[model samples]
Target chain A: MVTRGTTTATAGTTRTAEERARRVAADVPDPELPMLTIDDLGILREVHVDGSGHVDVDITPTYSGCPALEAIRADVLTRLDEHGMPDATVHVVLSPPWTTDRISADGIEKLRRHGIAPPGPAGGAHGDGRAPVPLALTVRCPRCGSPDTRELARFGSTACKALWVCGDCAEPFDHLKAL
Target chain B: MSGDTTSERSGWRSAAEPSVERVRSGARPGDVSGLVEYTLRLGDDALILSQRLGEWITRAPQLEEDVALANIALDLLGQARSLLTYAGEAEGAGRDEDALAYWRDERDFRNVLLVERPNGDFAETMARQLWFTSYQYELYDRLRASADPTLAAVAAKAVKEVAYHRDHAAQWVLRLGDGTDESRRRMQGGLAAVAPYVDELFDPDGVTGGLGAVAVDPAALREPSERHVDGVLDRAGLERPPEPAHVARGGRRGLHTEVMGYLLAEMQHLHRSHEGASW
Candidate 1:
């Protein structure tokens, strides 16, 4: 009677097949943002294995219209298959929904390294859409690290980003919007 | 119950289950009466608006606007897919999102008449967006607490996205309204044109009424939407369109404008023509 909702990845635990499956799934890179893995994006929620070694992997999307979801799903399956689990199941969950804060610190650093601006901390206590206005911090340019930037458009090439240009560096970049 | 639970625990049955079904957790499929109808009303609104927004992909006033509208359309389409898929599951009918979207006739679509209204001009488009997105923002915000887990989850994701959409619309409304005299006139006209359809969005109906806490009463969303939109209008220096004498209704019952037929034809023709062709 294995239950859901348990967190994975502590330094010292009796390693099991489920943990191995988690590592494989977590290593799958995000299709759209290749700099980060699904685990780094915090979409890889839970990976479980039954007694027969059947694997169930749960993931959530950063946004509802995230086009890379199908690719991520296929990639996870393929990675798990390479790890000797061909018949793994991936489920997309929406509860306790995905937020910008879920992007691991390493993922944020990766985005910065890749010339994309990272989002500020999503400070809303509830998913009720009423975000506290004071946290509307400036998005610095990943290139020049300048806080002087202006938005070019609210929407961008992808669903998760907004287009902005740095005033000091005069460089246009994508800022991941805090949802 | 225990026997079914035991079977569900066996792994095979739950492996290929749809996201909506699996995330619904403890709720029984098709348990909520009127759930399908209520879900379709919301789903169809998103679908139709998405189709309308998709029309602006290359045709928007600027290149940035084109990308913005396209991104917004994609988001709405995503929401529609989630909703219509959930609606199909609640119906327990073999229909899926594609079936509901591509197969349904205009008379069968449950979207509000406002969404299917032709995107007349850029100002009109912004006006329409302002009204609809603000309403959706309110709707999804309150709907996060729905008893149905799928609907609640959908609302949780949607509310965040819709806030950005509302900002886009309000930004445009302000730019056009407070700019030139000619631009102000067009924005005013655009607002007045859609005023007739506004009442129907908030009209209390049987589907929402019967669903208890599982559905947020559209009537309850009215005050907040108005408060928010009115603030935008004030800042934009645009007058509130007067309450029209005739309010268009019956969209919840599938009655739509004649233009809906044209919109439906264009949207459904590809799928209807191909029938099951996939890449």
Candidate 2:
């Protein structure tokens, strides 16, 4: 019975029912960015199973007003139901708020491979609740592996992304901004 | 941008509706009437400002500024969506966000005077943004610890977004204030024009009273809010405009300037024209 801050079991090990539930819950893809699963984005916060086999999934929205949350909620329930755990309740928690630092290493790789530049670590004074405007230190162009790039707009097609143009490749791309 | 019905624009309706229902209909919680009024005040501020910002989409000085203003507008609209929906639910009336936002007359809006003023120019808009964002940053920062969980949640999320907005406005202020002589003149005029409405932001009225810890008294935020604005002004080589003898007030009491009527008319025109419609 894992609660907050408990680590998940490693791959190739015997998985418990709770672990299996976590796996299914984590596999739900983000509605906007389909290349990365909710697990990859660090949005799938917790999955718990009781002796009665009831599962509770706690997830956080990347943005508070994110319209995609409904889609993500629907998808999470569908995925868990397909895994035979139809009695799943998805709770959206807002406290401790989400940050880009929560995205896993694998998630970064998936984003880069999908031709999107993943966000750098958040650069802000801790405990202030005001994140400094994200300054891209070295946003290497996703199309051409070049370090030369210029930000065009602080926003893009979605709230999570910023528009950038690769100076080397002369190709425009989206850089996922640190939340 | 064509004359399509709401249903014809699935993108518009999906983007417009509140994704989550924060207010559950039961015994309304925590000074229910005051809470409902307080929520409407916040929601109306966001909704009205968003409409003003949306007007800058293709009209900004540059493409980047256009995108930036549009993005800011979208964020405000998102916050408005949640707060308005919650307010409607708390009101115990059948009014949803749409009813409260589009159907209501100008006299019903509860936003502060700063947001309802017309967007005079780019510099004028920045001045309004500077004042409002700084005030919001302080308000939301404290409201994060509200006794009401929903308000706290909204504040926690909104503080992050408004931080960026405050930064954006500050940057523009510095640039325009310290730029060419003509630009500096306009920026200064903009600051003076927006100065009268600044005091009303800190006025503590009945909407915020009697709520205990759930509501933040706007007066308490005065010091820090001014500090933020002063720092930005100092950096931009600007000074606070002298307080006008007569300050505008009464937005909290739903007495807004004549501009509010025109602003609401343009905002609610399509929605009222196409009643009971969904995109």
Candidate 3:
């Protein structure tokens, strides 16, 4: 069977299930934004595996109304099961709510390459006696690389995205909204 | 709107009747101090308003508006789901979010009258949204400090969403309210229509009194809520509609407007029809 992670010797064990399980879980693509993996999207919060191979994964949804959260959870489990993991459970945690800034640089590049505009920095600090105020950033066209994009709609097909039209290219695209 | 049914007049009905009884409460068990009641009030507000906003899906004036409104609706629905689920668990009742949402009768709903108000027109929708979200922004901002961790967490997430929504609604109020005379008149009329129902939102009685910091005092929110609305109105060049002589109240105690029945009928019909069905 194909292993999910690099087999590294740890203590007395050849390779730990936790490390393999995490890689398997992280490789599951986001159902909504398929170009990004759960790890890239920063929703996969925690993963743990016991000696017997029972696994627990923690995830957070980018938006409270995000319908893809369940799908994402299922995809994680299904991928784990397919990768030889049997006992696994996904738990959703809401604290320290997901913000767009959590999206990795690779994920941002992936989104740009996929024709969806990545989000700007959500806020400066988290839980620092501040909430995210509306921060207007100049959105550039992912295709033509023009900064003259105008938002066509504040809401898009998904809760965490917005519809925008690039002024220069005249192409409409999905923008991951900064939460 | 003035307390058309003001006197907290024993609005409780026997959950004994009907098809939706499967969505029944455990005879208000474990809810004596009204934490469940408090939680349900917030949840029902989101649920009912979300339902109203969803009606604009295809009918909105513009395609962009349709998406915007629906997105807002979904945000509220998400908040409702969390709050309702929390309420169910706290009440120690078996009811889940769906059961609470799809099973309650009109009188059983603890949502304020403002939300259940008809979606009169695009301008009216904007007006109601501005007032509600302005109030909600302030409420959720303060609610983050709630002693109840779940409520606090829900508020922490929701405060950000409603901030976006509140800004969206305020911009519309400014746009339509300050536009053409025709647009201005309609926006003003919309404000007037929703004015009477605004009072019920800040009613401080019922569940909140005993709940301490776990519950936000509606009284504490009134000043800030109005200040925000008034500031928006000032920028929009729109006059604040005079307070209606009759302020609608009693929703906190479960007495709702006449339209609530129709709204509930539409919302609860499918679930009540297929009692235990799930996809």
TM-score of each: 0.91, 0.82, 0.88
Write candidate 3's Cα lDDT for A65-134 as tens digits: 8778778978988999999887887766566667888899999999999999888877753344245354
**Best by the DockQ measure:** 1
Q: For residue B48, what is the lDDT in candidate 3?
A: 94
DockQ, per-model, please? 0.40, 0.20, 0.26
Q: Report the TM-score of candidate 1, chain A only.
A: 0.87
Candidate 2 residue pairs that clash: B6-B279
Q: What's the CA error at residue B252 for candidate 1, in Å?
A: 0.6
Candidate ordering by DockQ (highest first): 1, 3, 2
Number of clashing residue pairs in every model?
A: 0, 1, 4
Could you tell which candidate, 1 or 2, scores higher by TM-score?
1
Q: What are the per-residue Cα lDDT tens digits for candidate 1 across B1-279?
A: 656333223211111365444434555333454888889999999999999999998899899999999988998988898888888766766678889999988788899999999998999989999999989998998888887767887888788888889889998999999999999999999999899988889999777888888889999889999998999999999999888889998788888988998999999898999997666
> For model 1, how does the per-residue alpha-carbon lDDT over A28-105 read when each residue is reduced to its tens digit?
999888989999999897787875678888788777878788788889999999989887888776766688889999
Tens-digit lDDT track for model 2 on B122-236? 9999999999999998899898888766677778777888877898899999999999998899999999999899999999987687787888999999998899989999999
What is the clash tally of candidate 2? 1
lDDT of each: 0.83, 0.81, 0.80
RMSD of 3: 9.3
Output the chain A TM-score of model 3.
0.87
iRMS, model 3 (angstroms) = 11.7
Model 1: clashing residue pairs?
A: none
